[model samples]
Target: MPATRRSSLAIAAALLAVAANTAPALAASAPAVPNAPMIPSGSAPHLVGPHGEILHSSSSNWSGYATTGAKFTSVSASWVQPTATCDGNDSYSSFWVGLDGDGSDSVEQTGTEVDCSEGSPLYSSWYEMYPAYPVNFNDAVRPGDHFTASVTAGDGGSFTLKLSDTTQGWSHTVKKTLSNAALASAEIIAEAPSDASGPLPLTNFGTVDFTGAKVNDKPLGSFNPDNITMATNGSTLATTSPITDSKDFSVSWKRSS
Candidate 1:
């Protein structure tokens, strides 16, 4: 606290002229920005302007008239609308939700039970109607029949489903359906369904909603539905149940010309 020395020589000459103009602008911009594409300074690609308003990347942290990232803490539009486009409309983007997607055009399920033992049944069932148009896990669903399927039961039963399985010639998704309208000729006269025979072909797997029913595929001492009814037609698929009072209940098929 002696003499002032003229305010510390004018703040040391303004800190040496701001360190000589920041070291020559960082040595002439580090060799013209070598290895560029480094937009990572907290990842930047921000576009959410306003006049019409549009900027969205929310994990959820939006608040008030100025915000960014992790979330802006909490505040929003009551009268600040601007989803972007005073007049440049044309945005097409959204992708995910497609594992045989569920746009449902023909995926039926039904029931109207009264099983006196298996003869008072009226039912319907069809799976994979529209959402199954994405085949080719190995291509081969395009045989002489073009992937067929069928199941009609209850007094005039019907069952047909020939996807070229001279014994696994290549086709599977009946991985099991139906439960047993005699299980389609006892697994199509038993065997060569392309080799691994016996258990699969249990086309009559009735586990949809009647509570229980499983035949030749025998999940364990089968048949248990007081009643059921179902339907489908992207070509053909039906089911009617009665279980056993003798009004005739059991159908099957495989046709899709």
Candidate 2:
């Protein structure tokens, strides 16, 4: 895969500029998904293996998984949305479960975002089929709400993404088709999305815990595992929160870059 365009630092920045023009503004009271691509952007540095599999990432993000040799047909995780600190900057971050795009052209992902704009925080749910942009659902999400997200590959290049807010008793599911999917990696991540300027400043959301993580029906630890932290400009941006078992772990917000 040779660190395809999606993971390239230069290309990610270029795409951000193009996509930013179409990105939507934060909605008031109701969460809306911005038109951000789910690929790695320049602001967050990520390491890739010889074949292009993601090894680790730094800065406003963390990716947790074991390299399953791309055979993963599905991935899932559950987390509680963290309260985010808004400092009047247009900062953003997301917690998602995805397959591919770490080392492949396609990523099928679903998650929730906590974003700060104009001194306030916006909460929303979304699903993305990458290369394409993310689509926001109208589901109401609040800090501390329990959410579960998953994506499964179907026959003939089809995928089904599902999101559930157990705390709020709301759920949404969608099925879509995407050709050229590499299916080369699966990840559970907390990320900073990109905008015209760059990766939008990361929101100062506290620790986000992801539990019941599984790939191909196997627990996260069964594959090997990479614990990631985000760092920028020689400063730590995020750290892996403590976990009692492989099935669950956390990514804590350090300081925004």
Candidate 3:
């Protein structure tokens, strides 16, 4: 998982959990899957311009805006669920808002996912307190659903992760604890989700538009965020747009890699 440094114990536990159940509680909906891990493939190297402007950065699995250099307490964003165009290949993507994944080990995050399996598309939602496995919500998720999500850090290693699909009339709230969380950065991202092996191919999720992006109750751009482009082996997989109104932006899928 990209910023989630899972321990051997966590991996073993996740595998056991999956082995214990051949099927999820509901057959018609997505199972309580845990494979979407944010494992950082590589450090995002920051590029600064001559005038000291934050130019851009690149990651293997992440594309969006991440702000560091401050102790961030909260991050929030809203986006319409993107429709995934599936082929025969298995691919995965997620849209989310999170904290502590830029330079730190843990990520407290929640959002939605679109995955391709056997030429079909699966839409679901989930949250992860990294190092631990992600827990998928059973709520029905469809393309074009309006979603809002946030991660807020409280005192004493406590945190709240919330995701709401207004288009579907449902919401999920999770409270977790990460005693060593860095609170180092906040981000709104579109990601190519990963598993134990490494990053999976990105789904063709056309474009996801993010709005009302905020960190610590202020516009995200106020902190000078890094615009991340997702690439691997010099091949672009996704690209993030420049932030406008200090709050809105979009991420477009480029290739499956």
Model 3 collision count: 7
lDDT of 2 by residue, 79-125 (tens): 99888888866567888998886556567889988777556667778
Clashing pairs in 3: 1-37, 1-38, 1-39, 2-38, 2-39, 2-40, 3-38
Q: What is the lDDT of residue 74 in candidate 2?
A: 90
Best by lDDT: 3
| RMSD vs true structure, all candidates | 33.3, 6.5, 4.4
| Residue 23 lDDT in candidate 2 | 34
For model 1, residues 42-83, the per-residue Cα lDDT tens digits are 122334444322232111101101111211111101010011
lDDT of 3 by residue, 13-32 (tens): 54344335423211113323
Candidate 2 accuracy as TM-score = 0.79
Evaluated at residue 158, the lDDT of candidate 2 is: 91
Of 1 and 2, which scores higher on lDDT?
Answer: 2
Q: Candidate 3 at 164: error in angstroms?
A: 0.6
Measured with C-alpha atoms, the lDDT of residue 251 in candidate 2 is 84
The order by descending TM-score is 3, 2, 1
Give, for candidate 2, the lowest lDDT window spanning 10 residues. Answer: 1-10
Q: What's the CA error at residue 15 for candidate 2, in Å?
A: 20
lDDT of 2: 0.69
